[model samples]
Target: MTRPPLAVIAGTGFYDLEALEDRVEESIDTRWGPARVTRGSWHGLPVVFLTRHGPGHSVPPHLVNYRANIRALADLGCEDVLAVNVTGSIDPGLVPGDLLCLDDFLDLTRQRPLTFFDGSGPEGVVHVDVTTPYHPALRRELLEAAVAAGHPLRDGGVYAAFEGPRFETAAEIRLARLAGGDVAGMTGVPEVVLAREAGLRYAAVALVVNPCTGVGDSEEPITMEDIEAVLATSREAVLAVLDELVHTRATFTEEGTG
Candidate 1:
């Protein structure tokens, strides 16, 4: 019997799924554009991976083809999506390398294709409820997997999605903190929102890579080098969580398939 496709959307510093042994690249065409997706197996379960920032991390945050990426996964029969986000810490408690299972988001993005519902598309404006953006079941599974894997994880946090290739200014970070953002990042916005619109179960596991402009132990300006260092150290924890997540999903699928 054939297995269902489970999609994993990888963020910065995590462009590839090292655990997937048998892999194949499948290019998909969507109304917005095209996405080159990687399909493979994770612990015997079928999985599909898409680098949100492209394979070489060439695409900037603001330039990511959110609509096309989500559409491609949905078109390929992906019913559930695990979005991996690399974020900057806003709350003092969430330090570099901490993992957060995001429960909410504030979109501060200015411009991008935020939706699939352009009246020009085949399906005209179809508004989906965004009251609770992340899928409940998926979020629960992720949290459970993290606990089972013995990885330190914060169960819930608000992710502030900013429009950027640029890091947030200190002033902007202060403003975001006032607005109740616990974690800040560039790629979570339209991607999570678009996933709901596509009728796919979506949940994000964010790894805090740095202190948001004004916080933590930073005295110098934040740089890609700083973020990379933090992510490099945390990569193992993230992978462990992912491995458990894949196992959890496989267990869920087995029960349902039975």
Candidate 2:
């Protein structure tokens, strides 16, 4: 049987993958709803790309249809998912443009569909283990690829997912930091949870776009203009890491060593 394509799910400032070739947009229907994706290839390997926010970044993190997006990727025969999340540094040492491979997450999202198995289907009331929320092998590959691309990612970090269309408060950032969150973002929770439920090997690369509300000496409020400035310069580094990863995967597949 042919192997499923590798999937990449990205949020904010990442609308498309410039490296993806032969791209075709596809709208997939799921029990949850519908999701739009671009099917293409990278380094001669099949890939499925999904942007969490809709065109022009119209969708906010709190309003994203996580179920539909996860279901769509699963239906598309995607076995491995590589995700990118733009985050603010909760760890004082981190700066804008720094990248980290996430190993754990604290889901602080209050209201979102958290699962696919609602006991409505044959599976019924399923509880998936999240001891190792991020897949080990995939995380390793990402770290290795980042190094290969000269954009080394910090090996591990904890991601805190907040419910937001707005930036977090200083107190909220402090709370997350106390809980060992290294970075904070809006859209990592149920998506990662749902990916595990779907049996897809998932991993995420976090790009630090700014210091969270109270981190560092800056008391300045977070602004999109500053965040966009970081993304403008940092996006290519994330893409470079991904490019190397796809090239490595393609090589391993050709050599039958994957």
lDDT of each: 0.89, 0.94
TM-score of 1: 0.95
Q: Which ten contiguous residues of candidate 1 have the minimum total lDDT?
A: 211-220
**How far out, in Å, is residue 67 in model 1?**
0.6
Candidate 2 lDDT over 1-258, as tens digits, reads 345899999989999888889999988999898999999999889999999998889999999999999989998889899999999999999999999999999998898888998889998898899999999999999999998999969999999999998899999999999999999999999999999999999999999999999899987889999999999999999999999999998988888854
Q: Residue-pair clashes per candidate, as listed? A: 0, 0
Residues 1-258, candidate 1, lDDT per residue (tens digit)?
666788999888988888886999888999789998999999889899999888789999999999999999999999999988999988987888899998999989999888878788777888889887988889898888889999977888899999998999988888889999999999999999999998999999999988888897667888999989998899889889889988876787788889
Question: RMSDs, each prediction?
Answer: 1.6, 1.4
Top candidate on TM-score is 2
What's model 2's lDDT at 228? 97
* Residue pairs whose backbone atoms clash in candidate 1: none
